[model samples]
Target chain A: MLTPPETEPLTPEDRTLMGPGPSEVHPRVLRVMSAPLVGHLDDSFIEIMNEVQDLLRYVFQTENQWAIPVSGTGSAAMEAAFANVVEPGDTVLVPTNGYFGGRMASMAERAGGEVAYVDAPWGEPLKPAVVEDAFHQHDPDIFGFVHAETSTGALQPNVPELTDIAHEHGAYVIADSVTSLGGVEFRVDEWDIDVAYSGAQKCLSCPPGASPLTLNDRTMEKVLNRDTEVRSWYLDLSLLEGYWGDDRSYHHTAPITNIYALREALQLVAEEGLEARWERHEAMATQLKQGLEALGLELNPEDEYWLPSLNAVRIPDGIDESALLSDMQADHNLEVASGLGDLEGEIIRIGCMGYSARTSNIELVLYALEDALRNQGYEP
Target chain B: MLTPPETEPLTPEDRTLMGPGPSEVHPRVLRVMSAPLVGHLDDSFIEIMNEVQDLLRYVFQTENQWAIPVSGTGSAAMEAAFANVVEPGDTVLVPTNGYFGGRMASMAERAGGEVAYVDAPWGEPLKPAVVEDAFHQHDPDIFGFVHAETSTGALQPNVPELTDIAHEHGAYVIADSVTSLGGVEFRVDEWDIDVAYSGAQKCLSCPPGASPLTLNDRTMEKVLNRDTEVRSWYLDLSLLEGYWGDDRSYHHTAPITNIYALREALQLVAEEGLEARWERHEAMATQLKQGLEALGLELNPEDEYWLPSLNAVRIPDGIDESALLSDMQADHNLEVASGLGDLEGEIIRIGCMGYSARTSNIELVLYALEDALRNQGYEP
Candidate 1:
């Protein structure tokens, strides 16, 4: 017999999450997490599933019948998009602008697709001409681009133009909307995106489980007619269709509590109209950006492509990024993140997203940054 | 622009969960799920992650040092075990007796492994001689068996004997302990199993995300040195090691609230000693079994291999299985499942697991079954 390790009651410190993701979850969503469980196959739960799909369609602004929540976090949904759409022996064109694009490339490669890159710098969005050139040069069957890069805080502009290029080349387009879906302006149908996926924790103000994913009939058709079996049985959409589609059959247990949380979170989104939510995020982030600029810190992306959900600011000269972040946590119980991938050590990301995108939170972030900078002997 | 769906607030019916899984969750675990969010990489969250791993290790009864929660549900963890350990062209041996083994074969095939099966009847446990014969014929590189068959309520007895055969043949073994981990007697170390995975919703009685998985150093060595990349990036252990291992870096945003729920659930297991908890399940299930027998019902499995956590009873002649289950729910807010796969309409599965394994829940099940059966014109 093994001796059990003595573990204390779970008392995690309540943090003001202002990092790249997992921003403050809404109280309604939190309360929903505590609700009692029902079997995944319960009639009531199937109703809940229908409502979730409908809510997801509203949020993604698409009439695609396949709007559903994937079982894992945002990354699982991201992998599902690539693993289903990019078949074996196909060429997948992915952006080189940020961390998520790199992730898409890895998933595509593992899904047996040959990956080709459309080059862009870390703090910039892909230009339409460059995308056109990549399409012509690579002649890829599938193309993926990050709609809002969480790492660099750059929003891809002219989405319709990029999708147009893909359509003209007869290539399907997949959008990584993890940071932008609910908080920023995005239109899956209007933008002609074949598929788009988002994390619940970021803009939905829900915890990170049961992420949102939507696909048009055209893309799903391609996925359904794939030559090779999808490499991941769990992420394979063909099998998932039996459950999420009209059949309502068993396909593993749905995260019932997480689905409840997401229902509440999306209900909140519906109550406060989508345009209002997007405006609120932009207004809060504008204030946060101004305050950081007032502290002599430069915002990384230009206004044309700046992402309002996540504000990436260049770390001031002589400011230790790690110490600055830890000081914020130690002093204010707040969280902000350092840059990732190509922009590592060059920037600090402060998120103004979903439930965290409020005047009080933005004010707290500004005040905390000022206090930390003063302690670091930096004068503005 | 699409109009938002006028979804009602989340108010799901609070039914008693006594199905094959998602058996009633402990209130403490439910309360923990409502706790506020912290950044996934926060210092506080890192501590929570470590505590979760330690608690999982205690419940799994293994010193394997690699016990951690997969980010998704039970199936994801099951897929992870096969996707990582069974590389391309590897011959994997799986059982043909139950639904989960068929799922294993599918996942193994997706991972590029050619699958061979050891045959057994759906309601019976595997024979050691058959497993040895199958291994000798197939020269398998991996073998997988279910420790507790939820579909048929049969426990795989003589686990040490099964694992010994795999070891002598130089094959790694994976155990699906989904229905047996915390509420039944499962000794990972004593049985010398290389890998085991379970769902939080089952014997652990947490929600259906963030499942438990443990692998010994030997199997992890093969995972780490795989010539081909893991098929699913989200389930990839090598990438997950960066987050759950000593590195404590980012792989993906974990299902945070689910981890909190699992921590509290496992803490309950530690508080009530494992032996006492297992005994409680057995005692409660014994009462349930006797009551069903009094109603002239026969359990599917023989006494020698009956699984106490999930009691599979054969449906009576002329009984409408669907109506009987619905009546239990409609008349009394209770849940029990119909058999899956081979025994699909022939048996009703009543789960006694974790928080659901109690005198009251068991008594309710017996009473509800008797009432529903009486309503269906069955006598005695």
Candidate 2:
């Protein structure tokens, strides 16, 4: 009858956010999140959005003419990228190594495009030569692959080489960097990636709402010259241009508070240079990998293709996975995730991105995991 | 090398949000919003999410079992409804009156459906007879339209009749009640609305991140039995069910703080009684309408179809719209929007929704508009 019990107002339960995303929100970011809500169209808010666009361009290392945050989650940006670039009957080649790449193929299909796949094992990166073979084999209108595979903890290598091969075949490269953007090296312009998108919750440390998207002039020209109107009126970049661009028209109400939090998170990223941030994540990951090995665990992906942001560790033989995870949660208040898609039950994913990429947090999780496994009657 | 100035540190400016949402976030909701972050799968957060589900079911006036807030904006909820139900080559009948209805048709097309329209002029409500004719002519598999036309301030009439007609034709009804849900009377079950989605900022008095969506058993079965995976893996109900349903699997990170705000806002609705909340909006709208008329302005829609949540006032002849808006901001610190889409420069949209539907606020806007209009040289 009364407003649901105030129970406990957010008590800031301190825990290491070591999962695929929603990597721990920085305290500075959280402080900025507490800032007052402003009108979405206020001059101040628009000014902030403009700054976010500029910073995103810097982190992505792109001078793309079109760079903005789409109003929905990372998936919205993914759909927007495909919806804007791929037309009906157009051919799109997608990597079949991870769940996200499959997502691109499906969204492109909805956009009425035919899709061909360049297959790779779940924990392996697509070889650039294999991509070249696919280019010669299918002659796709668009080529796309995941930069960091969140599902399997695999970082695809040879990004620039793949983009070069695609561009040679007259295909635009679309990169899904949801788990890799700020914490890894992404030179969109240098790598010749025509389109790229990432989620706010990952390396940005913002809550998951808006998605950052960037497209070069060549891709923008293709979208501008589309024979048909963009299928989604809400996500249509042309209409969105007025809202995100200089002439702000009322398209839809932006999520104002989420934008506020994102601006703060991106500010933190800029304060720490992108290279420094990448080093932080890499160092923390190295610490966790060493600690886990010392505790008698093996990472699912081989060292050659491992993702630093998210590491998938195989559950040691003769241990109850759920019991161990429960112990970690009930005893340690830590949140590491089980695997998704085909890798469930066999692997555990620990993230080291954004605010969670601290050496101290990694040490805590490793210590807690060792205790939890021992408590579950596993010999470690 | 510096972060954007806007991100330097957020200093929240206090402004009266009188345009379309996001309305001024209620103070209590703001407090709840700053609640410390919790894991999406945390027991405490899920406890809150369950309460949110129960509250949403109550507010939507449905027992459809599948009711949860989609993690994106209102448009994302709209996209979810279509992406789940409309497979490739399906026929979707939509009304073409206001901008939102037009948006539904385009989104349906993007989901790989063919769209047919029941025509209504901008600023006019859809006639049930025209929709019946459309059903007969196009035999659409899905019927989508706006319940409250946000852009034109037209509240479509005869929801029960429309749903009945849609059902008779074996078409699922998708209702866009973004602007009408809490302020206006909406009975998802009573009106036979198979799928209904709404935004929080309108009558819920919260920030806009999560969108409430409800699907009836029939609609749920179709989505469950989809032939092809819903195109956008992110929006696919199959994946979403694991997160929002009883079995909580990891989906994309959710906008957790926004959900807290929505839960608190809906709790306010329950405390005041849904019927009482509707009456408050109606009463305030009456006050606003009377005051605007006294100020010599005309409400654009016919009296019967006018939405109480949104008021459209025709710009007085010889008045410069931009200057009038500028004066409203500078002189009174009031925020209102100029016309959108085809109605540009012809009308001003003043929303008295959610927290903004207060008597004192309405009175303040009335006095401010009077002075601002005269200052801009309007003959009033």
Candidate 1, after superposition: displacement of residue A207 in Å?
A: 0.5
Local accuracy of candidate 1 as per-residue lDDT tens digits, B280-340: 9999999999999999999999999999999999999999999999999999999999999
lDDT of each: 0.93, 0.84
- Which candidate has the highest lDDT of all? 1
Model 1 residue runs over 4 Å out of place are none
Tell me the tens digit of each residue's lDDT in model 2 across B199-229.
9888888888889999988999999998876
Specify the poorest-scoring 10-residue window by lDDT in model 2 chain A.
A1-10
Q: Distance from true position, residue A344, model 1, in Å?
A: 1.3
TM-score of 1: 0.99
- Which portions of model 2 show Cα errors greater than 4 Å? A1-14, A228-231, B1-7, B87-91, B112-114, B129-141, B225-231, B377-380
Candidate 2, residue A176: Cα displacement in angstroms equals 1.8
Give the TM-score (0 to 1) of chain B in model 2.
0.97
Q: Write the per-residue lDDT of candidate 2 for residues A1-380, one digit (tens) a residue.
A: 11223333434465567878778777766666555566778887788778778878888887765888887778888888998898878999998887888788888987778999998987779999899999999999999899999999999888889988998889998999999999987778888899999998888887777789999888888988889876666677877888887797566778888887777777787878888888888988999999999998999998888889999999987777788777887788888888777787889999998888888789889988999998977766
